[model samples]
Target chain A: MSLITPEFGLLFWQTLIFLLLLLLLAKFAWKPILGSLKEREDSIDNALKMAQQAKEEMQNLKAGNEKLLADARKERDQMLKEGQAMAAQFVEQAKTTASAEAGRITQQAREAIQQEKNAALAEVKNTAAQLSVDIAERLLRRELADPTAQQKLVDEYLKDVKLN
Target chain B: MKRLLTLLLCLCTFVGFAAEPAESGEKGGAFNPGEIILHHVADSHEWHWFSTDNGNFVTYLPIIAYQPGKGVAAFSSEKVAEGKTYGNFKLEDEKLVAIDGSKVYDFSITKNVAALAMSSLLLVFIFSSVAKSYRSRVGQAPSGLQSLLEPFIVFIRDEVGKKSIGPKYERYMPYLLTVFFFIWFNNLLGLTPGAANLSGNIAVTMALAVVTLLITLFSANKNYWGHIFAPPGVPWPLYIIMVPVELIGVLVKPFSLMIRLFANITAGHIIILSFISLIFIFRSAATGLISVPFGLFISLLELLVSILQAYIFTLLTAMYIGGAVEEHHHEEEHGHGEDFGTAEQRAGGSNVAHLNRPDVATH
Candidate 1:
């Protein structure tokens, strides 16, 4: 029972001192400490948020780079296909031109050969006639060795010319 | 964990074993363990350091008293050291009083008062320096005493203060921190030799409780009062029964707070003193072999209790404040249930875990 007893003097003094202590501490100690703590907390939260934002931005950039690479690959494939088609067309054009030119040269050579053969044939006919004429003149010269024969031939020739 | 449980089991066995003889109030030789413990724990006019065969070593403090007709009177407490009456006043059972048996108001600087003043000064000294470092070293890591105190300060702020007090925790931080360190430091000092059990004194605890009560009621908004007086869902007839219970609850909360701290600290002191008394009771110096070990173990346990009780006191204070200033209608209207606060704390059982539970066996 004595243990639970309360004295007025102790109560008064304890209340007075405790209230004074509370007032003093509330003014000086708690204000600054809590302020600094909250500031640090806010700053930490902000740093984490910024880091997350930066990570997302990096992911966006990586995706963009991949798309650009894919586009570039597609463009290169199209250009290669076009180049191959043009090369095939060039080969086809070259073959056709070469065959046409060869045909024209062959026809011209055949015409030239035909003309040369015709000229050679005409020269052969002329030679044969001259040879025959020479033969006949020689025969006549031999036969007209006598004067009477020459007169007879001349008269023959004259008579034939008059009749003509 | 098993180990801890065994230690706790041994502790409880020892405490239960100790409480028997203590409550029985038996006497051995000329020494009454109860008297020694009570005297040591109670507040007095002078500080008693120790006693020798020839004399007692004590330091006198100032005594301030007020009498109805005398207005105000101040003098050194030593004037009544020899049990002499001074100015029609004498020291009766360590209390200053008038010879006429009239009412007197005593505001003396007793031993506990001096201790309270000194501890407050110590707080100002330690924390003012810490506050200075906070200003100078913004965004940098803590150093020195600031580092040591930061964990506890942060623990109270985050675990106890913010978790329990919710969004408006900032407004109550000063009171919470002050009460925590004040109780904790006083409790630790009480464990030291030649120091009064400041927290063990009912008057001191009551003072602390009164402040808590004042803060809680004043901070309570209309919604809190509404919940108490008119309640939300109960039928009108139940309010007659419900309102009185709620009102009684308000008084019971702080009353329990006061008694909890006082009884715990006082019981610890009594148990430790009884263990020491066992040595002297057997009239054999050799009994010290057993008693001293037991005493030492209990003393070590007391060291843990010193911090635990302080934390419990502050945590309860925060909880009471939380109940008072808590915002509820928004949640009720939107069917958010009792879950409030942010995403982190809104997690399951957090509110109940923080607000309602007590860590009785904290060590």
Candidate 2:
């Protein structure tokens, strides 16, 4: 079956009715329809403008975020550099303190050893002096006890000793 | 330069043909309308000797015998008296003046209106497919045919109806869309083989132009009527002259539309046909060889023109609607002028009172 079966009489009537309907539409419906279209167009334009503004705002925020990130990175780098310098200074200070403590301990040990050596030498010297005194006394006593022989010897000695 | 050369060649060929006698002494031959119409309308496979199925009778229809030594031969019908052989042929004037041509007849082959019906069905099938796609999409985004049509629909809405009819554009959208599609579809169909005659008919164009006229008249605003009758700011004498002129302009606009479309489409068809007919006229192999390239070139140009004509018609119609519904800015200007005049009058009266002194005037 053909889709477009154009009946002449039918088409004529349809065309006439269509024309009349168009006239009616122009009279009654045109204004409201046009008004709605205008509103739609205006809304679309407004939407586009809003979208453009939002895009611009996003771009500005992106730029701000980039700058903040750069500043944060700079701060982190500065902190790292300062931390490295402080760590180096701390290590030097610790080494100086340890060396000073070691030197003081060694000096104190040397003084203590010298004091002990002096005490020991004085004690040895005192003992030797006592021993010598005792020995002299004993020899003198022996000589006194020998007096019996002394009389005879003295006569002979006096003659020889006249020169003393 | 090519086109000029072709024109010269055509003129030379026409003149040469005119110089030769029409009667190439072909016997029992006459021009038949049925043959002529059939020859023009149908697709010809090869040039052949056309004759009634009974072999005895022959006519002066130049038969391309399609043989090596005999490419073209004049055949005589048995209806002719028996002793005269093929040598009896002669040429008289530009037309094929047949010797012993005893009868004069005129007739035409009836065209099949069924073809037009078929064309309409084809149109419905194509558009229905597009329409079906649109319906299936429902609330979703348009795809396929809908995608193609949506832009054109939106273009009409945004560019033509909205911009032309202003606040009241919605009601006119349906009409505008119908007209644009109808005209464009018809124009495209007319480009197909055997379909050129429909658009060539003036009646079709007239009906379309009438629709445009009715829309403009009915949708016209108060400003449009005022401009037609009193036309603000024009002097009385000039206004009297302009009143009829503006009224006539209303009628003439649609009339011009009708003529422009009908003439352009018809003329293009005629020019293409005329170029194709050149091969038959020249009869020389060298001339026939040149016609092929030239005919193809002209056909290509016509294709571009066909689309262009449809666009121009639609665009102009939109412009006319824009003119009809647009508000008159001159009326506002007139009101401002009146206000300025009243202000000047008040100033003049105050100045006169301040300057009033009888004694000074008498002195």
* CA shift of B65, model 2, Å: 46
How much is B126 displaced in model 2, in angstroms?
3.3
For the second chain, the TM-scores of the candidates in order are 0.83, 0.58
Question: In order, what fnat does every candidate score?
Answer: 0.66, 0.01
- Listed in order, the DockQ scores are 0.42, 0.02
The share of true interface contacts that also appear in candidate 2 amounts to 0.01
TM per candidate: 0.76, 0.48
Candidate 1 stretches with Cα past 4 Å from truth are A51-85, A96-164, B1-29, B330-363
Provide the lDDT at B76 for model 2: 25
Model 2: lDDT to the true structure: 0.53
Q: Top model by lDDT, which number?
A: 1
TM-score of chain B of 2: 0.58
